[model samples]
Target: MSKGVITVTDAEFETEVLTTDLPVLVYFWASWCGPCRLMSPLINLAATKYSDRLKVVKMEIDPNPLTVKQYQVEGVPALRLIKDNALLASSEGVIGKDKLLSFLDEHLNSN
Candidate 1:
């Protein structure tokens, strides 16, 4: 697990993400996915940057089938912004640092 990110499983998803007071950025990924590997550092940076306002978690899709299916995550390197137990936004593929931060800010700033 990264310094600022928490690794979550299907069993812990509800408690770790949905019930938390702050917004959560769920990073859905797979070990074998090349792009997922590329996004790891960016996710970690986002976690540190938004430490006060958001909770960042990583979920490995293979083992976390329940959450992956529930979230309708069709691919690896997926991101879901969850706040107040609801899905605020979702993105898939490898996104750059600036775009990732902007994506988070867009939703986080409004609420």
Candidate 2:
């Protein structure tokens, strides 16, 4: 677990994500996934940088099968932006910090 990242489980997915008032950024990751591990620091940065506006959450695919299946996520290190229980946009794989911030800025600005 990284700093500022909320580790969410399958049991708490709905309450933690769908019911949130702020825009939720869900990081779908796993312990065995290399890309997920690589993206951890970036995730922490986003969690702290956007702490006031966004809610950062991390969901492990193995234990959280239902949420993953429901979202139809294809791979690890998937970053999903959600609001009002709707899937707004997503990014896959290990993206650079600059691009990640750009993506976050765009979404935050639009929303």
Pick the lDDT winner.
Answer: 1
TM-score of each: 0.96, 0.94
The alpha-carbon RMSD values of the candidates against the true structure, listed in the order shown, are: 2.0, 2.3
Per-residue alpha-carbon lDDT of candidate 1 for residues 47-100, written as tens digits (9 for 90 to 100): 988888989999999988899999999988999999988999999999999999
Off by over 4 Å in 1: 1-3
**Clashing pairs in model 2, backbone N/Cα/C closer than 3 A:** none
Candidate 1 least-lDDT 10 residues:
1-10
lDDT of 2 at 37: 82
Give the C-alpha lDDT of model 1: 0.93
